[model samples]
Target: MEGILIFAPFFLIPYIMAHIFNRVNYSNRWMTYIFSGIVNLAYSVLFDFISSYLKEDKSQPVCHFPLFLFPIFFSPFLILLQFMFNKAIIKSVKYKRNDSQNEQ
Candidate 1:
């Protein structure tokens, strides 16, 4: 339960970032992908740093692998998720606009 709680942001943040990036720069798909990847990488590094800092014991294992490597392992998946999310958001907005225009 605690582990799930700790890792929830790894999945959620990318979706949120995708929505934000799509809103901010809907014209450029590549830019949205690049920016979302950068943001997720930064977030992974920051999360590792904070978790390490908050640990009370230096010797006990908090994670199976090195904390610094967490981003490397997870970044690709996060970026892919962001890409998919951005595409979905763009499609939804396009449909919404079309619907509204047709109604007018």
Candidate 2:
């Protein structure tokens, strides 16, 4: 769908933000996932507004901010991403633990 175009840039923005802003000590995965989603939603809206101007739409709507609601529309994918991030972190921690144990 053409609507998918507006969300293209957002797919990665939130995931990257989740990593960069991720708190290693925090046990609340939900908080991290939701916070990152919110941040990316804001970024996606801004990107949509800015990109809409770049688009050659002669009949462009006055407000393209709604285009950035992809996260809301694709919440299942967001949850999947959260699962992946958590799994990866768990794997990394386990790997580190194994390595330390081996070193001793």
Alpha carbon lDDT of each predicted model: 0.65, 0.62
Q: What are the per-residue Cα lDDT tens digits for candidate 2 across 1-104? A: 45565555346644664575455544655575777677667767766766767788759566764665566777677767766766665333333245666667
Candidate 2 residue spans exceeding 4 A from truth: 1-18, 21-23, 56-66, 90-104
- TM-score each candidate: 0.59, 0.57
Q: Give lDDT tens digits, candidate 1, residues 46-75.
A: 767787778889998666355455556777
Q: Could you tell me the TM-score of candidate 1?
A: 0.59
Clash counts for all predictions: 0, 0
Local lDDT at 19 for model 1: 69
Model 1 residue runs over 4 Å out of place are: 58-65, 92-104
